[model samples]
Target: MSNRSTRARIGRRVMVHTPVGGSRSVMMGAVAAVTLATLVTGCGGKSQDHPSSSAAGNPAIGKLPQATTFANLKNVAKDSGADAAGNGTVAHPTAAVPVSATPGGPPVATLPDKELGGPTWVPVVETKPGWQRVLLPSRPNGATGWIPAGKMHTAHSPYVVKVDTSARRLSLLKSGQSLGTWTVAVGAPKTPTPAGRTFIMASLAPAKATYSPLILPVGAHSESLDTFGGGPGTVAFHGWPQKSVFGQAVTHGCIRVPADALQQLAKVPLGTPVSISN
Candidate 1:
């Protein structure tokens, strides 16, 4: 009945689904693989129970931004000027919207309006007239899909998180200005942190706050582990109590930041862009 006991139970449940061939020792001391959708309240205080997938429906075709070829869908990082301007745009689906492989194309997937009990806010990487190409929180890193822009709410996030895996550093930026840079811990060489552009998928306060007071799940998933802790191998930015781990590569795939850094990051809004580089 105590909070500690409750958290212990949750932690145990999450750790039950370890990697296929990995031992308990291998998973120990790594980031806890808590289920993103079930563990905690997200930015909007909602919880989701399913992963992003296709929904059965004939989606309405709206006026597309432009007549670009399907090839453009592969260019996930080519934002019209959002990334370059240092202020990325975020999109929120007003409803469960159908996603297309290309602008005005047939529905490939249906994007839920919420994830982890919060508003599903995704970074808009590319744009056509009535369509916006946004990052997806599904399998295959760097996945993107086009959705009708007219049916979504839009906002610009001034905060950007940059992690340099090679240097073991994390930087926070706002409005093209650096807030601060700190030494952080990245993934080990074998289970290396994936390098790409992702957004803050959700913010969670775990029941067991011993490992970290807060966890910021990103859109990216672990490349090495198909499943961890009874959930998809989703990576995150969290605090590590061990000071010695700073500036080291010794995690499963999460970025371990200092207490101060975590405090600052906890304020960052979900859907803000995060750029991880080698």
Candidate 2:
């Protein structure tokens, strides 16, 4: 674990998770103690530690999708063709392999020889031959891209998390059935929690000075703020010490859960689906 300085930027009004109103900006005052693995991606206002660039000379890829309407941003049902969830390691013939905008499409981002240990990704339901369409842990809430299937590895998770912002509730499910539910704290009106499909990219525990022992960073970001708590506006599922925060709209953009709720959620494997709704 280590410490780092980061910058915060102001953003637009968004009613993502729970509806509460005001100007939502990134919190930049605190010096957060973060795990080394987490620092590679979500920390310091950066999403991925791997450097990316456009690829060239690849006829095996196809066209890229528009950022405005990225497919797979909506609900990811239990059987979304994403049979497994796991971290990606670039095992291709070369470093800086192209990540397509769509399955078998042109490159949108490139992967490095090694990832700085980033988030988990789910392959798209219907993938092209030899290519896997995987969700990315980047901006715009729900982003997906394509990577070579042979270049990655994954594991399955039966657990899933569904959050209802309007009701201020968080539910844990195993194989589509509810295991438990808890009241939670969502984003305030100005910096409302974003709604969409995302996944647990990483499981982290801060060394000190935090309310929660575990932090589940999702593949989503705060639509209202550019950064918060030294992160690149990455929305996370975490716990708070105060019971008063639960069932309230009072966070920058993170889901504030209870201690007991976090304990149960801990059992969920990394890369599990996390759906947030209005």
**RMSD vs true structure, all candidates:** 9.2, 8.5
TM-score of each: 0.74, 0.67
Clashes of 2: 8
C-alpha displacement of 54 in model 1, angstroms?
11
Off by over 4 Å in 1: 1-48, 51-87
User: Model 2, range 1-278, lDDT digits (tens) per residue?
Assistant: 01122222223111212222223222222333223223432222222333222233543322322111112222221233243322222122243355666565646554433223433344233357888665555565556666777765555577778899999999998866789999998988777898877776667666552456777777677786554433456678887766888999888778989888888988876557777888
Tell me the TM-score of model 1. 0.74
Candidate whose TM-score is highest = 1
> What ranges in model 2 sit over 4 Å off?
1-97, 111-125
Lowest-scoring 10 consecutive residues by lDDT in candidate 2?
Answer: 65-74
Question: Which digits, one per residue and each the tens of the lDDT, describe model 1 over residues 125-189?
Answer: 88899898888776557777888878778898899999999999999998879999999988888
**Scored by Cα lDDT, where does model 2 land?**
0.56
Clashes of each: 7, 8
Local lDDT at 27 for model 1:
34
lDDT of each: 0.66, 0.56
